[model samples]
Target: MTPIVVPVPGVFPYEQLGFTNCVRHGDVLYLSGVASLDAQGQVIGDDIDAQTVQTYENIGRILAAGGSSLDRILQMTSFVVDLGRNGGGYVATRARILKQPTYTSAVIGVSALMMTGLLVEVQCCAAVSN
Candidate 1:
């Protein structure tokens, strides 16, 4: 199968950041990390809950661009700068978004992300029915 590069508008400035949002090969989409950023690639918020929610929304949009959806996600990896402070809330928000607990996931703490005030960055792999 040919690999398709799915365009996710406002995900990031690819010309500057040099990262693709998601690449679909066959039914699986390998998604790159996404955060709560606006169309201009600027960090959107300071609150973790708001960032987490926006991150999921961005992920859902990217997945949809790749002929997939949130429910098709099989795995996810999250990086958080303030895990101790936002861990519980982030997970709770994620649980609300996914609406299920049957997916593989891993969370890692970090000193910082590429952008300031970016509390979390989430990446996932999903299946698409194309």
Candidate 2:
């Protein structure tokens, strides 16, 4: 099956970056790692809690654009710069944001990401209606 790239308006500068925010194939939608980036593509948060919320907000937008919702998410993989310091806040923020609490998830510790000052980055796989 041919995969279709998903676009979320004013979210990420995917065109300049040479990548799509999300892609759909068959019944699944795969999202790229979402960071705490504003419409101008600058990192937005100084701490983990704020970054976690922003990351998920970005994820929500991508999912919506891809014909999926947060509740339809099947799995999430979050990469964090300081898991030990921020993992709890990340988990708490996620719980607060997700109404269904049904998706499988993981939080991984990383030394750094593509951008500096990025506390967390979230990627998801979700079910999209055919």
Candidate 3:
């Protein structure tokens, strides 16, 4: 089957950034790294706790737009820029967002992210009912 590009809206015009928010093929959906930015593409959260919340909120919207949801996630990978400095807060925030029966996920530490103030970027794969 031909892959359907899910029109998952991002905080900014994603096409200009050389990416689509999410794409769906068959029953699977793949998402780009979701960030903690607001509609104007401004970084909303400085700390890990605040950033994680905003990042996941962005991911939730993308998943929904892709005809899926967080619970259907098969795997998730988070890129953390300040893991060494803010690792605890990142883990705690992630734990709060991902409750019981959480999906499989991995966190990778990076020296820096694309954005200066960004602490985390979350991407995932999920099964879409549609």
Candidate 4:
């Protein structure tokens, strides 16, 4: 099947990355891993709480462009630089933003991410109804 790419105006067409924000194949929408970059592509905040919020917001925008919404998200995967230090805040943030608690998800702790100041990254998979 031909993939349909969704470009959130300021987020996609990453010149150096060569990838879009999200791509749709059949009924599934595969979203790229999103960081805490704002509309201008700069890291938004200093801590995980702030970064998580911005990351989720970025995911929301990409999902909308993919013809879906946060409610349609079937699965989510979160990556954090330090889980022992920041896991609670990340879970709280997810609970606050996602109105319903029906999606499947996983959180992982890693040594580092692509950007120095970034503390969190979120990636999601959504199912589009036909």
Q: Give model 4's TM-score versus the native structure.
A: 0.91
Query: In order, what lDDT does every prediction score?
Result: 0.86, 0.87, 0.83, 0.83
Candidate 4, residue 77: lDDT: 92
Tens-digit lDDT string for candidate 3 (1-130) = 9988887665554677888778898899998888898877889978899999998888888888878887788888889986788777888988887775557878899988887899999889989865
Give the least accurate 10-residue stretch of model 3, judged by summed lDDT. 7-16
Candidate 4 per-residue C-alpha lDDT over 20-120 given as tens digits, one digit per residue, 9 for 90 to 100: 67899988899878999876678899988898888888887787777788889999899988899998998998788897987899999988988788889
**lDDT by residue for model 2 over 82-125, one digit each (tens)?**
78888888888888889787889888999899998998989889
What are the runs in model 3 whose C-alpha is more than 4 Å off? none
* Superior by TM-score: candidate 2 or candidate 3: 2
2 or 3, greater by lDDT: 2
Clashes of 1: 0
Off by over 4 Å in 2: none
TM-score against native, each model = 0.93, 0.93, 0.91, 0.91
**Which TM-score value belongs to model 3?**
0.91
lDDT comparing candidate 2 with the true structure: 0.87
lDDT of model number 4: 0.83
